[model samples]
Target: MQATRTEEKTAETHGGASSPQPQQRLRDKKVGDLIAGKKRLVEVPYTASLADTINTLVANRIMAVAVAAPPGQWIGAGGSMILESDKQTGAVRKHYIGMVTMLDVLAHIAGNDVAPAVEGGGGGGGELERKMQVPVSTIIGHCLESLSLWTLNYNTSILDCMEVFSKGIHRALVPVDGHLENVGGVELMESASSYHMVTQMDLIKFLKVHEAELRGILTRRVRELGGLTDIVFGVTDKTNVIDAIKCMNSASLHAVPIVESTDEIGDDHGQLVNGKDRKLVGTFSATDLRGCPISQLQSCLHMNIVDFLEKLLDTPQQEACGLRTSTREHITCQPESLLREVVDKAINSHVHRVWVVDGRGLLAGLVSLADIIRMMRVWMLSEPA
Candidate 1:
C-alpha cells in the first residue's frame, strides 16, 4: 500500500532526506554549441536567375538569401567566394552587400510600373509570373541598402546573439572564410563558409523544447523579463496606404501595427499622429501587398489604410493581400502574462512578434521570440556557475 500522509509526516519528523533536483543542461548550452543538426550553410550565386532564387528559397524553406559578389564589389551572397577573413584579426570583410527575400521580390513586382495586368485575374497573371524572367541583379534593387541586416559568426554566443534577435529583426548573416582547410590535421578539407543564416524561429524552437525543465519559467511574467527591445514602428489607421508601406520599407519592417490616428494622414510629413486614447487596431504586412490589383497599385498609395484593410478583407485572395478575412482580430498579449504563455502563444500562432499591451489595453511594446530567448540567456547567466 502507498504511504499515508501520517506516515509521510512521521518520516519528515524523523528527518527523511529530500529528493534530489534534476540537473540543468540548457544553462550550459551556448549558441556556439548550436545543435549539430541545424548548423548548415545554404547560399545562392549572384548570377542565379530570379526563378532559381525563388526555387532555392522554397526548397531550403528560408526567407532570405545572401548575394555572393567579389570583395570591393557592392553585392555578395551566401557561399560566394567574395568573403575572406583578415588573417591578423580573423574577421571577415563586409563584402555582404545584399539580401533578397520573397517579400522583396513580390513587393518589387507589385509596385513595378511595367507590370502588366492579367486579362482575367485581379492582378498580374500571378505574383511572380512576369517578374521571374528578370535577373536578380536587376529585380532586387536597393534591398541591401534598405535592410538593416545584422551579422553573426560561427563562435557567437547564444547570449550575445539574443541581443540582435531582441529587435524585431528576423534573421542574421554569419560570414565565413569560404576556403577549405584541414580540420585538426584531418585528411579531408572543410569549406570555410562565407555565410549562414540564423533566425528568431530557431531561437524559439530551442526554448520550447526545454521549457518544461526550466525552473520558475511559468511563474515569471513577461513584465519581469529583460532585453525585450523590438522597436515598434506604428502607423495610424488614417494614414495613406502608400505612406504606411513607405514607412515599412524605410525601416525594413515586416509588419506595422495600426493605431487610431487623430488627423487626416497623407504624404504630408507635417501630420503628427498623436497617441492619446488611441490603441493598436490591426496590422499591415508585406503579405498584404501581394495579389493587389495591378492597375490600382499606384492609387493604393493614396488610399486610406482603413479603407485599404476593408477592401483587402472583402476579397483578400483576389485583391491587395493574403491576410484572411476570417482573421479580423490580430493576435496580441498582455505585459502581465506569463513568459511561458507568451512562448506558447508565439509558437501556436506562428507570429514573429507578439504585441504587448498594458492593463487598459494600450500598446505598451512588443515581445519577439528573440526577446524570450534573450531572457532565457539572462536566466542562464543568472544561475549559479
Candidate 2:
C-alpha cells in the first residue's frame, strides 16, 4: 500500500508541472503563422553630406538610416551611421563606421568635442568631424529576415497576441508568406493604458474625452516640452507592464503616463503607491520603470506613502540620459521659483531641469538648464539698460 501511494504522489507532482507546458505549447503552436508586412528602410548615399543626412534624421525623427552607395552599387560600402553633412556640396561625410544613437550625440557634446557647433560645415568648420558613422546594410544583422518578426493574423485573439508580445518584442512585422520578404501587417504590443482595448463603452468615451483635452494642451507646447512627461502619448497605471508598453507604441508617444486611474488623479491601487487615499501617491515615469521587472511593480504599488513620495523627491535626472532636462526635485511654480533658486539648485545638485507644479502639486510646466543660461544671457544683455 505504501509503495502504491508513493507512485501516485509522484505522478501527481509530475502532472502538475507538465500542465503549464502544454498551455505554452498551444500558445506557441502558430510559429508558422504569417501576416502583412512593410519595408521601412532609409538609405543614405555614400557621397551624401552629413549635414543633409542629419537633417533627414532630424526631420524624420529616425535614429538610423541605411547607408548605401549612390544608385545600384551594392558590392562596396562606405559607412553605417551618417553624422555630418556638407553645406556646400550637400554630400553627407558620414562615418565609415558602426551604429550611432542619440547617446552618441550627447556623449560627443559632453566629452572632448564639447561645444561642437551643430551649424555649418560638413566636417570642416563645425564639430561634425568628431563623430563616427557606418553603413546600415553591413550592420543590419546576419540575416535580412532577422530584421523583422513574423506576426499572427489580425483575427487572432487579444490574449494570444498578448502572449506573443510577452515573449519579448515591442512589435512584430507581419509577412505575407511564412517569410519576411513580403511585409504585410503590424501587431502593436498591448498596453495597459490603452483605452481602445477596453470593451466597456463608458470607459472608452471617458478616455476619448480625456485624450482630446490632453491633445488641446499639447498643441500649445510640443517643442517647448522637453521631458518625457511632456510627450507621454498614453496614460495608465492600473495596467501590467506589458499593457503600458503597448500603449507607448500605439500612441507613438515618447512618454506614457502610468496613472492609477485616468478619470481622476488617483483611484485604483493597482499601480498607485497608496491604496487608501484618492491621490497621486506616486508616478511611474517611463524613465523610472525602464528595464524593471513587472513583479517589482506590484510591490511598488504597496509601498508606504512616505517612501513613495520620497522617490519623487530625487531628481529624475541622470548624468547623460538624454537631451531632455532632468531635475533633482519638482520645483516649478507661479512666476517661477525665484531664478536664484533655480540656478543654485542646478549648479549645486547637478540637476538639468526644474519642474513647475501648481497649488495642487500636479506638474504644470518646466524650465530647462539651458533656459537658465538663456536667462543669464538676457540679464547680461539688459545690464547696459
Cα deviation of 198 in candidate 2 (Å)? 44
Name the runs in model 2 displaced over 4 angstroms. Answer: 1-234, 239-336, 343-353, 369-377, 380-385
What RMSD, rounded to one decimal, does every model reach? 10.0, 24.7
**Mind giving the per-residue lDDT tens digits that candidate 1 earns over 338-377?**
8877888777755667887767766777887767776776
* Cα lDDT tens digits for candidate 2, 1-385: 9977777776687874433223222222232321212234344565554434554554443444444343223332222222233445645443222222222222222233223222343322233233323223333322221233233443453334433443323333221222333222333221111011111121112222333322322233322333222311223334543333333333322232332355645443322222221222233333333222222323333343334334434433222222222222333432334555544444443334444444665544445443433333333334432
Q: Each model's C-alpha lDDT?
A: 0.58, 0.33
Error of 1 at 41 (Å): 5.3
Top model by TM-score, which number?
Answer: 1
> In model 2, what lDDT does residue 241 have?
36
lDDT measured at residue 294 in model 1 versus the true structure, 0 to 100: 41
**Ten contiguous residues with the weakest lDDT in model 2:** 191-200
